[model samples]
Target chain A: MNRLTALVIAFALLLFAPARALDIQLTSGDWQPINIFVELFLGEENLNGQIPSDIIADDLTVSGNFRAYKENQNHANAMSAERLGDIRNRGGEYLITGTVNNKSGKQYTLSFTLYDTLTNDKIGSYSIVFNNENQRLVAHNVSNWIYETILSKAGIFHTKVAYVVRHEDGTNELKVADYDGHNRLVMLTSQDHIISPTWTANGNSLLYVSFEQNKPVIYQQSLLTGERSIVANFKGSNSAPAASPDNRTIAAALTEHGGLQQIYLLSGNRKARLRESKGIDTEPVFSPDSKHLAFISDESGSPQIYQFNLDDNKTRRLTFGSRYNVSPDYSAQGDVLTLVRRDENGDNISILDIRNGDTIPLTNTASTNSPSFAPNGDVISFIDDRNKKNLATVSVNGKVIVFWRDSEQGEIINPSWSPIKSDWF
Target chain B: MKKQNFASLATIFFALVLTGCAASKGAYSGNIEDDRSGEAGLAPVSAGTAGKASSPGFVKSSTIDDERTSTDSLLQKRIIYFDYDKSAVRDEALPILHTHAEFLNNKGGAIGIVLGGHADNRGSNEYNLALGQRRANAVRDIFLSYGASANDIEAISFGEEQPRAQGDNESAWQENRRVEIRYTDE
Candidate 1:
């Protein structure tokens, strides 16, 4: 019998049976926590459906809800309508079933359906036809749809991530791609080396370090035009270039005379020294108001993040939990600051609430570095090297979604999210 | 009483051995006894050679060759200092530059020389790399004007990666802000 007909017959049988005390007890209690099981079938056959099922489970768990279960055996033949009724009676609130078929060449067709276990009725259905390379993204969109249908909130499945990928020979390149590792593009390529790619106020341009001329110089590049130029040139070294919220000015760490590296402001051809410290001060980031700067310095004999007031030129230390805290990025709302904190154990990403200065750990998974915030400031993108390869983009709650996942390609590191989409040609 | 005397002798022997090892390695060499020969009129030697002389007890005679000895002697007679953030041979470095120029003019042909420029690690690595290249180029230009062939010289910048001192103080930075001239041939 067809799967739908079998499910209907099973539901009729369960309805005819008398309601037992156990059945009532199972149906009560907050709907049994809603476990959604997604299976992928390819052209009337099953082709390693467990992998995609596991990926969906991981994405759903990011919400801190949902207990997803995957049946070990292929259910394409064994799961009859009676089994569906039994699952419904056992408190499995929702069931998601899908099929993946390889069309011509790299093309693929994925069919999915979501069913309400309580009534054994089909709630929604979706069909995605795409290339094999886009399979992960299709899964991401499917997960997002499932999330929205259940929670009434929009999903971030379609968002892109930007990061720096460096080779063992010290060749650094900037890359941007979909969060699930599709449509990868190289933003900046240099033979010398590149570090710390930061997105402009609008996501159209990126500001980063390039050693094309044999020194650490900051450059701003247009993503569309592929044209780049030096933004600031200082005598000793220039690094950690961060654009302000208004895009009117840039804040960078510049070494002057014989003093320590300090924060400086750049506007056209004019340069203004913002802070004068006797210790090593570097890694400058600006607040949304552009009136204050956050940076890392070794003035205390160890690296720590500090905040400097623009109007009065006063400075204050922002991080107190660790002796080594560097690469601080302020949120768009100006309420949260994300930074990489390192101690004796290892490095991890932590978020600091500006209102109360309470620091919280975001990634306890592995050695996390280079944390950058999305335009909305709700999710954070960072590089995690625990899996042997430098994979980028770990969610604020430590759910790592790999960007550009083809194993044949090199690794990705140091992600900087653009403030907004760029209009520059 | 006999045991006490033996302990004192052993202590003395150990102290002698420690002193022997310290002198043999020649690690401490910053002591000078002044004997005025009324040679105050002599030009003050450059800091590079002065540093070498102050630590004479540490450096062995085998490492001091005739060419290096002569260069050290000449460097003492002339001082070269660059302008702030500039690699161009400043007027202050003219005396030393002229000395090297005359030497290259006299010797000539097939000599390979390297100009190593360094920064104080104040800026980003990229900017410092460029600044260091500029400094080396400046010295190369001066050497060329003084009769050194372009084929015989090469310039490279280290861009604040290596420093002479390890502290964040100004004195340490001043010492690190420099370029070294190295010649592979006499």
Candidate 2:
């Protein structure tokens, strides 16, 4: 029992110690569903409520990654070490348990803890004060926090939505709301019709079409300030106006004398026609590099999106699956193009791969139009008509997030995301 | 003495009846007699007179009504087509433009009108919107030069938002690429 025995014992302990430390690296395929259990501590009585648990679980599941479980809370008051060990042994990598204390008539303080089951260590915790009305949003915020801590990426929880709301007087009103469709405010209002509210290079300003004088005019207004001004005025119909990445020029469809719609560049006060064709040409979107413009035209006898190089002026058709495709909005990254593809069944928002020319349907709902990519390009927002009600920011994934919803305000159409907001404009 | 008086009365009655019949026939024909030449065989002073006569009296009565109806029905000569991305009033549209100019000059501040410039459904919404503005400005310029005040008129471009015809055909597009003069108060 001397120096030799002590050295052997030290080496044996070092070998087993490293194995006891658990550090699981999850992949896209290897990732498992996180099971969450919540117990509302309202004093001594443990209230059995599925509302908060279901809401939180639903929020996580919508990310298309998590599969939530519903378990009985037999030992709600006693969440002992032995019980937690049993939950981890059952292949649950993560566990969430929270307590909600009602402070006032409708207000409540929710304190939650997220645990990494493998290490039995508290990875993250959140305490939010909210009312009954904001329970859904609070749940989403907590879920987002957990997602970011676990995935090491920010979730799209705090993003807002932009959409068009039609009034009873047949006037279109541009509106902005939170991602969950709360705190809605009208951005643009006119007695005449308004359509296609596109976010400027800066997310603070919105570029949209207004028929105040009976002609469609593109106007830019600040979301923070109500100040508005005319950006471009072209001949014939000017419907779709997309701002370039630099935010200096706007790519628009201008109708010339030959009765053909052509793409034009309107920068400051100078105007130059970009693409000229005998057939109908419209819907111009600038690539991320600001060197190419993706637009729609009937040059091929049917409406299809075409990408035109700003330098070489060579044009190539981007969409081939549908005979009709319009309303092309380039993503912030300029990798994918979000547009509306119409067929016999009606219209649906689709994402087109610029490299492969393959189109993937983003929204299955018919009559989904004016699909726009968020500045981050992780989510696509569009207008959808459901049960005769126009809903803005109808996500392809059933996130039920909205910037505005006025069931009685009439139909909402044409939603465009603002460009990333800059300090200049 | 009695026979001479009766013969004079008969002569007077015949003259009055003949004059009345001639005047009625001229008015019923719906042709404005030329100030230079009072010839019935000559063409109507303006195509407007012929249009009025062709469509019976029971039809609409406004001067612009007959012209609009006639132009709308006869599509071939009515629509003045344009080149790609040009808002300049074409040679064919000169006559109509002149008519509008004259109306603007005569009416002046008495009427407030909006020129709704439209584009065919072919371009992006913003491009069409700006293009519509250019078209509207073109018409507004013509009206202003003809004596209409800029304040009395507003030019708006409805870039490809509203279409007169739905089809993506040449005919439909021709109808869409137009700057319509809409009067707020007539």
Candidate 3:
């Protein structure tokens, strides 16, 4: 959201003094993706390592903001001014060269230097020493650093995604993995159903609904220690748990109040009902600023998304044309909200800009549910069940779409992308 | 709850399978690595296995046992089907529900009953859960009005998680959108 920072100022000043005949800019809109080249990482004994470099290139390309290419050679002087001129001639705007040092048996050090090819200026350098088992993560961190330094926004390469996978025997497993659906760790396996898995504000725990007790109950479980405690276990359904930006409060849809679903703000040992509606109200999601809550209510005859402000205690309808709309989530910037709408065609994902009431459909497939936004607000993830059940992610601009499935036999649903990985990981 | 116990349980299950002590029919027989075969940018093109029966019946059967009495015949219709998205009990379903209510009311003591509400896999899961709860509440209110004790009935919604049919068609949806009257023997 902070578009006019010192980095943008430096970019603007450099833009006036034209370094090359090719036009290049670092902004979010219709600008083309900058071409970046990564030279193979130089190993400690000139072993010619390609693991980290390959991961870095793939990360940049998957981001959709950069077209990354890997050079065939690796050396200290690979980016000499002559070679840099050649790169500029071929529309390469950035270059990354790194070194991999294998310290001891399982420890490794990856050091990278970023350069702006057009201006021939050294942008920055990052060094990460990690266990060899975390090679992919360390490489992703390097890519994140390069991305933040260039685009002035955090990259989601290091984040994780939590989802539910139903096995062939009707057992549901709650799994968390890297953003690309690798390095999966099963959090819980139960014969009951699990729904609405969300990350805590600090990214240390997850809150979800499980039917293990023969009724839906919300539980907050730590990802590190695997310890969990029940958050809500009312008489009726306690589902759709949404944690606020502050680590204190949780918004959930509970039916304990007169047996009809209503939104409630739960904090510590106190619970306060927020809305009094005659119809069904569930799926309460908090804005990034924690000043407003968006939820699905059928008070208007059909399920539709509504936003309620915490300050004024006033509510406004968000979606008008749809007879069925639910599962509302806000982007990190709190500018846009993603939801699923059902019509004569089928259930599909759509995004609504709060500033202007413009709604754009993201997917046309039926059975799409639980659309969630990435921390960077550039991508949205949802479950698509048109032909096969799978987790899908689409760029906010709808230009790039990717699907992920755990296996060929089970059903994967309820995907929630986590915030950027904290430093503890 | 701790998740490490899941790993331990899985280890025990694998041990049981190795020793041929567990049911080999429905057990997961594939390698552990097979569950983690999701590629980075590709979706699997293989078809999923056929869905099995998932009706949440406690101990009741759809057919009568021994001599078919009138009460047994009435109780045989445990499932009360509903129209799509409508929770109101159909006219044809009222006679069986009345019989259940009278049977529970005339009993000497409290006999627990659970109404497991379900929906077709058509809408959002959360919304479907809400709809199922509504259907369960509707049936519970009718039972209460017909002289059934409120203390003896508990209603819970399973949403679309437990579907009796697997096909993505109107027939399957109609079969799935119903409430099952389960008698919990105390």
Candidate 4:
């Protein structure tokens, strides 16, 4: 009787399941994730002593679009009809097979072929080479290829994140780490306070404020050469550096004239003050096209997000109904903004659709700060300080939330996700 | 007056320890005598005297050590605490600011001072930075009103980075929301 009931349930599930993988709607939550079987790349373990298939699978799964599993039974690099049939029976809608070819010293090429298991058709084959010491970049690149081929959207697995770690000894270290919070490199260390670390559009350098001279001074440091240059060292506080998408301008807040903070755009040696207000204007973030800058200004008697149009210099408010809303970060598509909205319940991260004035709460935590959008515009990374300070990332739809504890001492603050860059180093 | 000076001096000493001021470290003792050299040009104002001297109660006497110690006592009250989200100077902290203003007005261009403002971990970092900048500017306004040179003063905000207390309670928040006045040479 139990076997009969199980068979009936299985039949019912088969009848209800979507007929084709392409028919599955990516927007709905009720649909099953597209199953992918990743086979270890040939010569991958021999070249770098690392498996790219595992990383690829993890990236696909973390993307919330696909469910990936490893296939160890098939050691063949090339897909066969019988093997494809076996994978199709195991619920794999897609299969990924790859090989590694060593080009030269420290240079290796990763070749990948994506397959549609249901149709038994080869989608395409792509290859990416990496000479950097980080072998993980190859896998991330492969995942990006698969993601873009399938979803028609860019992948953020290869991007980096910049954050500040405050040590117990009163020193702060500005660090850049991979998106997974590994392979960290300390960019700057100062005995005094350091805050507001931002990245250049090209991801070549960083702009941040350091109190090493007993006052906040904005400095731009190159990640490639480790050279540092002062961007803004005005009389009063100079902070909240946001690089323009064009890579030619940086918007920062300076308390120059009367100690009232105002936004300014600094490009090359010419500085242009954007706004003049009696109240505070800060936390400037440029849109993807650099056409407008969304910033925090308290000119409305309460802190709120405002957008400054570069073409006409007209200002419009983006957030309302809340007394306190600051720290605005624009999405890659420039359609939505991720920011912190504070109310009676405490601070929560919310995303605002720019087309309409609708707001969606991405974090329900009482105290979350510094919400920055991933390059893909599907996720946001922020600092959750409800208890101890930690890092968290949430999908834009508020469906997936992941928390990462600070494995080292001290609290992690000011998490800024880097834009999508081609090079890992 | 001597007794009052001793009591406030001890209190300031404890405050220095609590605020983690560098002067409270072991280098404090020997540096006290050296620090006096920089202020040697400063002449003590006689009681109820006129000319630039604003605070009558802060009249300096010929007893050099007592006079210097009293000045140190007043200077050691470096931190000015603020209420939550409020940058305006409180009534209780006005007297301390007045003392600092008189000193800055008296010192003239001999020294440079930096007012490091800070905030608690409650709000966004950059907004708190602007808030902190407001508090520091508030303190700087008092000094400027007393005829202190704008060139000799630099007001900056550290936001929520440097907190005097690490707890997530009201007491810690109050302690963390403050403006710290320090001489540039320190």
Which is better, 1 or 4, measured by TM-score?
4
lDDT of 3 by residue, A327-378 (tens): 8899989989998877688788988998887888877666688788989987
**Which candidate ranks first by DockQ, i.e. highest?**
4
Model 1 TM-score (B-chain only): 0.57
Whole-model Cα lDDT of every candidate shown, in order? 0.59, 0.59, 0.74, 0.74
Which digits, one per residue and each the tens of the lDDT, describe model 2 over residues A28-90? 323334444333332312122124554455445444345444343534345567766766655
The TM-scores of all predictions, comma-separated, are: 0.56, 0.61, 0.81, 0.79
User: TM-score order of candidates, best first?
Assistant: 3, 4, 2, 1
Clashing pairs in 3: none
Q: What is the lDDT of residue A85 in candidate 1?
A: 72
Query: What is the per-residue lDDT of model 4 for residues B1-186, given as tens digits with 9 covering 90 to 100?
Result: 443364345434433342343222212111111101232221111111112221111233333332224745576688999989899988788777777767766765555677889999888878888999999999988878777777777788888878899888999999999999876434
> What's the residue-level lDDT of B122 in candidate 3?
81
Q: Can you give the DockQ of every candidate in the order shown?
A: 0.02, 0.07, 0.14, 0.15
The DockQ for candidate 1, computed on C-alphas, is: 0.02
- Which residue pairs collide in model 4, if any? none
- How well does each candidate reproduce the native contacts, as fnat? 0.01, 0.15, 0.13, 0.32
Tens-digit lDDT track for model 1 on B1-186?
Answer: 342354345434433453454345343222111211222221111111111111101112344244435745453343233454565666767667667666655645424455656776443333454455557667778878878776555555555655677565677666666777755432
What TM-score does model 3 achieve against the real structure?
0.81
Off by over 4 Å in 2: A1-59, A67-93, A99-110, A117-121, A126-140, A256-259, A288-291, A310-313, A331-333, A363-366, A375-378, A385-388, A392-404, A418-425, B1-186
